[model samples]
Target: MITEVAQIEVLPGHEDQFEQAVSQAVPLFLGAEGCEEVDLQRSTEQPGRYRLLVRWETIEHHTDLFRQSQGYQRWRALAGPHFAAPPQVEHLYSVLAP
Candidate 1:
């Protein structure tokens, strides 16, 4: 499986709204094809910073499928306004795990 990590920075004073938006958008990710898991993490040192982690069966499941689906549009619509800037996203594969 592959994990997509999106580093997002919310606009000042919009942190709570952004978090709520993410929560509301969870189903969009969960319902996508090949999506296995979704999670959101906040940076303790920077309240406005967040990391969105989504695990998929393959990289194409994210880049070629989900990103092209209507759910992706809905996701952006729900969470886009709160973004301070475009998120930095990357994908990773597990090398070793317990």
Candidate 2:
């Protein structure tokens, strides 16, 4: 499995708006092929920061979704203006078992 982590810094006073937009946009990713699940979380120590974690079957699947689908564009349109800057995204793979 692959996890895509997106660390976002939202503008002040736009937290709820950003969350709402992400809520609406999540279904697009969740509905795509190989998307296992999606998680949206706020930083406990940072007032205007958020994190988005998306689980995929593989990195290839995640890449294909971004490269071939319109969902990313829609997602950007919905949440782009709320961002203070571009999000920092990282991909991770599990290396240890629980």
**Which candidate leads the pack in TM-score?**
1
lDDT digits (tens) for residues 31-82 of candidate 1: 9999999999999999999999999999999999999999999999999999
For model 2, the stretches where C-alpha displacement exceeds 4 angstroms are none
Cα misplacement distance, residue 1 of candidate 1 (Å): 0.3
Model 1, poorest ten-residue lDDT window?
Answer: 89-98
Report lDDT per candidate: 0.96, 0.90
Candidate with best lDDT: 1
Which parts of model 1 are misplaced by more than 4 Å? none
Clashing pairs in 1: none
Report the Cα RMSD per candidate: 1.0, 1.2
